[model samples]
Target: MIKDKYTYINREISWLQFNARVLQEAEDESVPLIERLRFLGIFSNNLDEFFKVRYATIKRIEEAGKAARSELGGYAASELLEIITQIVIKQQSESLDILNKIHEKLEDENIYIVKEDQIDESQHSFIKNYFIQHVSPALVTIVLSDQVDLPTLKDSAAYLACNMKLLDGKCQYALIEISRTMDRFVVLPKKDNIDYIIMLDDLLRYCLHDIFSIFEYQDITAHMIKITRDGELDFDSDLSKSFIEKISDSVKHRQIGEPIRFVYDKTIDEETLRYFMDKMSIETNDSVIPGGRYHNRRDYMDFPSLGRTDLLYDKISPLPVKGLSLERSIFSTIANKDYLVYTPFHTFSYIVKFLREAALDPKVKSIKITIYRLAQISHVASSLINAAKNGKKVTVAIELQARFDEQANIDYAEQMVSEGINLLFGVRGLKVHSKMCVIEREEEDSIVRYGFISTGNFNESTAKVYTDFTLLTADQRILKDINKVFNFFETNYKIFRYKHIITSPHYTKSRFFKMIDNEIENVKKGKPAFIKIKLNSISSYMMIDKLYEASRAGVKIQMIIRGLCCLVPGVRGMSENIEIISIIDKFLEHTRMLIFCNNDDPKVFISSADWMTRNIENRVEVTCPIYDNDIKQELMDIFEICWNDNVKARILDETQSNIYKKNDLPKVHSQFDTYDYYLKKLQS
Candidate 1:
């Protein structure tokens, strides 16, 4: 049973495996060509954040001489860091290969990504004029010397390391910060009905002669270099400063955070690389990654369509839930039966409609909501503000520390605070990650509570690509628990007990464990017993151990996990009853659901929390039970739809091989099939 002395794969490594699935999409020629390029971009973006957050954390632990194995799952922190570096280097190399193949394929479609040398005479004038008109003034170039101190390189932006060799046996180094304000992929004037585009990096390379006209140099070479810094924001314990002020300062200071990883082109000159490491005090043990000619591939996410509809996935108009009406009162509909709004398949306007109705309704006494992340132009914030202006008591618990969205939330936080709305900055030592809203409406007989809980944020932007579930219910039992969670936010010193919804930082772990224990007990009693779960990630060792115990008790477990799963299933006698599969498809699988068999009576829940320890014990999260039988059946149906997906599902076993869960049975692409499912549901 001792397989390599460890039952689970490292979470970081499992995370990389998950990313590799994204990369696999890029490699699959069956996918649209332009979509493949964007997949490469997503892969790059995910890697950048991984290094910034996860890798940076392990580096700090290693630096403090506390590189313990237990803290990092199994390997010591130093060893884990080395392993991560090696894996990233390999993945970077593979990404370059996939990119080159995609470029070749793009040419077959009459779309070309030409390099600096590859541009023809017809495109020369347009390129030069475009550069002089657009690129010259925006450029920031710094000449390097021993006397002059190097400017702190931005972690998010990419830079070109310029090496110049002068006539009199001397060499000089310079840095050119790539302007993120400009587009990375520049579409040149179309010629002969053929689309031609050049990257911003190559455009600058083409204009290097013009850029260095002032300085006399024999030769100059530019190569891409990028650095990622620790993304964790440390707040000051200043009693005088408000929570917003502390968070604002922390976000500002994140720009100059310590470097966690340094990436340079493999062909970069040793002299320039050495000069950079020496000047920046980059140690040998630091993540020194070498990659291809270009970095910051994330900009590819916005790759120009070039009007080629044939080269992209066909856009699907979001389907409307049958019973939920957008034009009428959302509360009136929810008061009867609970409705589930599945995004990318179902329209997100229902959530907006619910809030807007609450905002305008004269009977609505008050609204309380918890916000984690919102879009740039958020309808959610505007609705909440409108409610405040309408004289309704609106209390907002906006988490100011929502990672990269901190500043955006802070801006809205200040605006909401100024707009006569009651704002709770955050709970001390707890980041409120729950997505919940409860509104009190004064009916003729009594005050009624109508609320919603979601497995995703209320942001309208992310709803397009991210698949999440938002449950709209008028069940007072559940809304009572939601209101308690909100009340506990204000009075955090006092603990609140909930009967319907399982909350984190106090009850999620114990309550969920009890669910698992029930299944285990039922299995021992020869009753029907099984568990099904859907999650973005699950790395909780305690949760894993409990599931293993259930598996040993012959309680069947099936998981549709989209991201980082450290649990190794399919091991004989240990996890034989547990089977896990991950689906990486056209849309991000972001739904979190859990189901347990209670003597053939199924109990199901939709949650805002994953099984990750942070979501369970460190943050404020919520899991609401499905009391409405119709909604419960819907959850079961969708989970089975996702589970039965053979086209995108990858088996999550001890090997971490990510093999497709394929058989002779008909192939089921869940994303498309899900939309069809909703379509049939609407018809039925």
Candidate 2:
């Protein structure tokens, strides 16, 4: 297959479309008003990260003189960058319009988002006092002048650019950092059963004179400007430094990474905008986005609900897995048969219960786990520490380079060390992106292994909103492979073989390629052959080519990819047998699962990997095969439920239009139906 014939979407363009789906949620009328607003916030937040990581990467590629067009899925880096900028500018404008529409609808419900100028006499005292107490001390305001270079602007932080005209006709400029310590949305005192809210931005706008009373300004204007810098950490060649030390230094340096994007209020004066462009050194190729008055709209994600249950999605109590019990030993349940825990549908407490049980279980001799990102207040860390406190040997391979989570993981690593838990900073070049845990327990006459593997982080906070699968099993074949992974962390020189679980940086690519080839061969013999995959992304060209090979051989392929799928599906002769859909709704579609119809007998696996080159060859990831027949059926059923969803699922095609899969059949809102599927199983 020549590079020219390989048809795949540019990952950057695909990612922008994924975010547009998020924006679609904000635009969807059926979504609860509060959730739609929060979706807009999520959309904004997702864009920030994209600019920092993906967009920044493409900028570097363009600077390196265009050698990686094949790698970028046939689009030139410079061309892709321009296309991304134009798409974002258009989305940013649409987001502003959507926000306005939401606000108007909010007013229909007597929930007014009153600006500083819109605030009446009834709200003045509250706003003034709120500003004095909450906003004043937390604020970081800087005055700007031509004589001084701008303070190293923090990446992804929103700042208000002020253009003040003094009584003497002298112009002064300033930048005010929005207080992260305070809520961006301030709820004012209620009047006549009507609620009024003011954004911190507008509150600051109202108090401009008070903020600069000493300046004697005749006029003042402020507009939001947010700059995103490259988030890639560049470690120095300091050999003697500890991994933690290196990570700390790199995080500090990340604040000063070259700017990849500069977003400002579209209505800001040309003079102010140009001053920002020149002073900030925003490059000609760097994305210059014209956003609304509110730049860091990610804050809208936490827009206070104002005690309005009617305006929010109905909360469902997380149900328990049919047979797994928090009261009983989780090991005992897994010891019987493999049990899968689908989170948001099933309670996250099972994971905590398992760890806490291990902490207290006398038979449990040792515990080994992998940590990526943890909740701010993590019970998982506490449970592991408890096990260490109880004289059980606890080993943790915490990835210190978990992107934006480096500092948090470092802090937890220090705390775990203080608690006497052995810590591994991951292998030198490969990040430990795999999520698995194995506990060795003293059974009658022999030691037995019990473990769980997950498709997402073990953070309970995210568990509530992100849909993921965690499989609990005492199967020796899978447990042995998991133990080998932990063993490799301690002894990086050894190359271990696996029979049941597929591991990365060694076997994932070859194993998956072999699987795809098997399907293609099976189809050649005129047997039933098909592939089903669910994942967060699939941008790997090698993996894409293999899939195209399978598709060409008439093996049907169905995919539920949540984000950044570069494969150009439904193309004649290239990928006609493949169809992919992405679902974005109340809960993020986060499970990474694969099923293969091998000569009518199915093979199933759940994975902690996307088909990205990073996951396949650059990181330590694990893909565990499902051995238990019942659990395999359960996984298949869940996949079918998502695949059949007409409400939230959107077709992924050559156009990248993100049109929802519409049908006249009885509506299947997959997430809701999935929960009910488990509920019905419990009753039966």
Measured by lDDT, the strongest candidate is 2
lDDT of 2: 0.92
Q: What is the C-alpha lDDT of each candidate?
A: 0.91, 0.92
- Cα lDDT tens digits, model 1, 1-684, are 221226777889999999999999999888999999999999999999999899988888888988467657778888888888898998999999999999999989989999999989999999999998899989998988989998998877899888888877688888889999998888998888889999999999999888777767899999998889999998888999988899899998888999998888989878888888898889877899999999999988999999999999999999888888887788988899899999979899999889999999999999999999999999999999999999999999999999899999999998998999999865788889999999999998798999999999999999999999999999999998899998998899999999899999899889988989999888888899999999999988888888988999999999999999888898887789999999998999999999998988899999999999899888999998999888889889999999999888999888888898998888888889889998999899
Worst 10 residues of 1 by lDDT: 1-10
How displaced is residue 331 in candidate 1, in Å?
A: 1.2
In model 1, which regions exceed 4 Å deviation?
1-5
Q: Candidate 2 has what TM-score?
A: 0.98
- Model 2 lDDT tens row, 353-468: 99999999999999999999999999999999999999999999999999899999989999999999999988989999999999999989789999999999989999999999
Supply candidate 1's per-residue lDDT for 366.
100
